[model samples]
Target chain A: MAKGYLNFVLHAHLPYVRHPESELYMEERWLFEAITETYIPLIKYFQKLVDEQIPFRITMNISAPLITMLTDDILQERSLKYLVERLWLAHKEIRRTKGHNDLNNLAKFYYYRFVEQYKIFKREYNCNLITAFKKFQDMGYLEIIACPATHGFLPLINITPNVSRAQIANGIKVYEEAFGRKPNGMWLSECAYIPELEDALNEFGIKYIFLETHGITNANPTPIYGTLAPIISPKGIVAFGRDLESSEQVWSSITGYPGHPNYREFYKDIGYEADWEYIKPFVAKSGHRVDTGLKYHRITGKTDFKDYYHPDWAKEIAEEQADHFMHSRINQINNSASKMVIPPIITSQYDAELYGHWWFEGPYWIYMLFKKIHYNQDTFELITPSEYLSKYPNIQVSEPAISTWGAHGYSEVWINPGNDYMYRHLHAAAERMVYLARCITKPTEIERKALNQCARELLLAQSSDWPFIVTMNTMVEYAHKRLKDHIGRFNALADMIDKHDINEEYLEDISYKDKIFPNIDYSIYAK
Target chain B: MQLLKSEYYELPAKYNQTVIRLLVQSPTRMFVYWEVSDETIKEFNKNNQNYSDCTAVLRVTNLTKNYSYNIPVSPFANNYYIDVEDSGCNYQVELGRISKKKFVNIYTSNIATVPSDHPASYDLSKDGVLFGNYLCIGNKKRLKIYGNKEQYSRFQNQNHTAFENRRNGSSENNFLGSSDNFIGSSGNSMCF
Candidate 1:
């Protein structure tokens, strides 16, 4: 019998970045890269675990925007097209590195990997990745959760009760529409929580939410079990705080498993190393160099000069690190379980893309980690938050402190001086939207479509990605443009509604452009 | 085909409403931004011709502690970060002016509550089910950093100082975006 439980939660998300107007937008590649590197690899491994009849339980929250993009006809075709291009690039690499044994083996590895991904994407899943995930959920191997409609930072945008309500309700609506059932858990936007969020969670039937470490430690009256067990809020919503020790073991990029010298270097891609003309077709259409997902070097100890990657050595290290991670958890679980009446649950949560997208060997690390947990030890077993709640329904009740997983564990990352200008526009738009939702009773078909699109624009404009990107200083221009564009569209639609003269052509144009929530009812704001 | 002529990149400078908004930036700092419409400014100037001598100030009242302080801000500035001394307190702010000697209130903000940064003093369990000892490795040192008054204040303010350091080219950690330090993948090193 297991003495403790380990809940692994992965929040997979990306801002909606579809552009039908032109392919020159380099930002669209964000989706393609993530699909090939993160989502497909995850699906591949999950499918393998099921085939081997390995007992494992994992929870994942695929955000609403990502679900919309995954199911869209345009982006689906683009994902397949993107994989085909990578396949061709791998073919070229195989020919280019025929003589060098180390480079040739790595090239062949990529070639087969892309081929398998293409087959799984095109034939096995029929270009719809959500179906693959849904199959896993139905098989009892995975628990899929919901996220905010646009990945908005809830605390910053919670100016009025209705604003956060609309974001959460629409998020649930999207999850239900995609999965054919209500989600039992929700990955709070950035794991940010305020006390008022409980009403919305209970209304939407969300049973649990994960928080940062301090959210549990600093709770009112102090949680008796600390972050070792889930705390129940007054409203009956279960809140699980992340365990710092386990988080540091896997998430610390400097000391974590991803930084091992044998792992493939995420930075040393062939897009910039290749002859400009040779790699031009694989990169952005504007002729700018970008990551082509063909990195060949290893992260060889903080130096500019990197050595050719050895996949065999990387696999051995992933297994070794898996052993290290498992043993560390076994000890942590045993030390705490002896002192408690009930088995303590250590919640380890991370961004799903970090595995394969950022750390090329991350997905395999997860695969090996699960296998070790199954075969190597009985000290702790993998469990989802929902499963744990089912087994142990009674929990300590406490109100979590306001918190987020960002720097210094608060809203400074989203509301700092660098991006404080957007909140005014966002709040004004939400106020106008609530008023419109209340005032507009009966409407024509065109007016109804326009109202729904207006809601979509407001949600998109409020995404935390823009502020986060601006603060990160990586894609400032694109982030600024996206924020401005969404706000601009929202105002234009509001004016059309106010004038009582809707532009059919203009409405059709933006309806196609920012069409995220197809089933979005404007009355969600009224609730 | 180009859809809807290039999007207007600039937002309206003002929404034509005189309003003040307060947001909690951290446990120790609260951000307040307000806009006084031109019409409201004209109305204020009409009432007091000594508008030039008036300084725009935010009168922050800690509703929980029953104390108030004033932060003088430039009339032209749109926002200011107000520092709070205590966490877990309810604060209400008013955007007004100090003309000559009297305080004239323009608009009052919604009550903003700063979050607590330390563990509570009491546990409700009668049997004294204390779980603090098992919280982390080096539990005493970690609790000292989180529960100690002066140390907790410095730790909370370190995030802002870190940002300032990065802006001044003194630190390598991008704070929120460095993949080497931050757990999140907001870094630009691998972003396309």
Candidate 2:
């Protein structure tokens, strides 16, 4: 029998960013980049593990917006175009760096990676990642979960009970449509929770949720097992607190294993390194260089100079890090088991993009870690939250302190000054959504489409990424425009509903653009 | 959609007199955002209610179990620091006008529970429009130096020193965002 359990959850979320109007919407690259660099790599990795008949259980949140993007034909085709351009660029790079052995190897790495991603994207999965993830779930190797309609920061947008309720309700609709089953758990956007959120989760029949460390440590009465045990709320929904030690080991960019000098440097791509004229065709229309995922340098040290990255060295380190991580977890679980009456379960969750997108070696680390834990461990077993909860259902009943994995461990990241002004607008829009949801006394088919589209607008605007991006100010104009445009659309639709003016042409235009949840009911927002 | 347990979300008292709503901001704070409507203000005016005499009396009632409270606010505070001891206890709040020392129910909020920490911890919740500018890896600074010069300059000019402060682990006025805070941000207020 296993002495303890370790639960790994990867949250895969990207804000809904689709531009049916533009052929080269620059910001849409976030989705394209993630698809090529993050999502496909993970699918390929998991496919290998499954083919070998390895038994593994992990939870993933296939957030609503990501599902919509993965299923859209335009994005699918655009991503394929993006991949083809990458392939052309990689082939050119093979000759460009023919003499430089290290750079040539790096170029070849990207070339084959793109080639394989193209195959997996087009043939294996047929360009729909959601279906692939759904297949994994159907096969019982993966536990797919849900998230808010557009990953709205619930504590802020949930001003009205109905507003939050609608976010949850619509999210469920999209999840069931994509995954073919009701979600048993969900990723609270930003992991931001208020004390009363359990109320909403229970109402939605969600069984479990997670919080950052303080969320568990700060429990009314300090938890006996700290983050090692899940806390069931006074309501039945379970709350898993993130393991700080494990989260920190992987989260630190400068000090984490990914920053080791042997690992490929995340920033040193060939796009910027090569001659401007030579790479112009591969560059954006604006002549700005984009990351080609063809980095040749290693994160040597604090200095500006870097070394040529050795994939052989990086894989060795990844293997060592995987073993190191598994042993540390084994030790932690064993230590906790010796003192605790029940088996201690440590939950390690991270943004799924971190694996292959940012770290590059992250997928290898995960692949190796699963192997090391399976073959090299007797103290701890890899488990899912559902498995742990069922094995030990009688848990301490208390309110897991309200928290999020965001900046300040609270709602400040979403409600701060730079972004706070948006709230009054957001809150009012939510109020209007609830009002229109209930007030549309009777509606024809056209009016009903307008109302449902209005619900989509409000839900899309409420995505936490917009405020997060606004606060980050990385793509300020884009984030700002997305929030305003959605609010503008919602307001226009609400006004039409109030004035009894239904414009089918306008409705069809937005429906074609912000087309996510077609069958969603506006009545979900009814208070 | 199957009806949510009517009791789970059903409002306790139908509040129509005032546009008053309560939010449990944190563990120890349950505050209401209220705008006494024209009718409410007019009614108060007709009844000879003065600003000094109108106190926002918050009433907390346990909807699930049997428990309640009537706490008086000091004349003009929209925020209430609640002391309801039960964690995850189901409760609702109502704000009223204490006219001539008599409690007058003006508005009530949807069912909510007190947060898990003192509301004072949220002093920084509105500290500033904190721009969180860091992700787990490949920040703008490196992106800039690595020769994505165009986008780098654009992102650099757009963000502030807060992101820099965050990465340095300074915990300065930046109020927190990513990297160090991603792993953990130590605070004196949490239960630990």
Q: Estimate each model's TM-score.
A: 0.90, 0.78
**DockQ of predictions, in order shown:** 0.18, 0.04
DockQ of 2: 0.04
Off by over 4 Å in 1: B1-6, B50-53, B123-192
TM-score of chain A of each: 0.99, 0.98
Tens-digit per-residue lDDT, A399-440, candidate 2:
568777877566656655577556656766788788877877
Q: Point to the candidate with the largest DockQ.
A: 1
Best by TM-score: 1
**Candidate 1 per-residue lDDT over residues A64-168, each given as its tens digit:** 999999999888998899899999999999999999998888889999999999999999999999999999999899999999899999888888658888889
Model 2, position B177: C-alpha lDDT score: 25
The TM-score obtained by model 2 is: 0.78
Where does candidate 2 chain A have its weakest 10-residue lDDT segment?
A: A390-399
Error of 2 at A274 (Å): 3.4
Report the C-alpha lDDT of model 1 over B91-126, residue by residue, as the tens digit.
999999997677899899989889989997653432
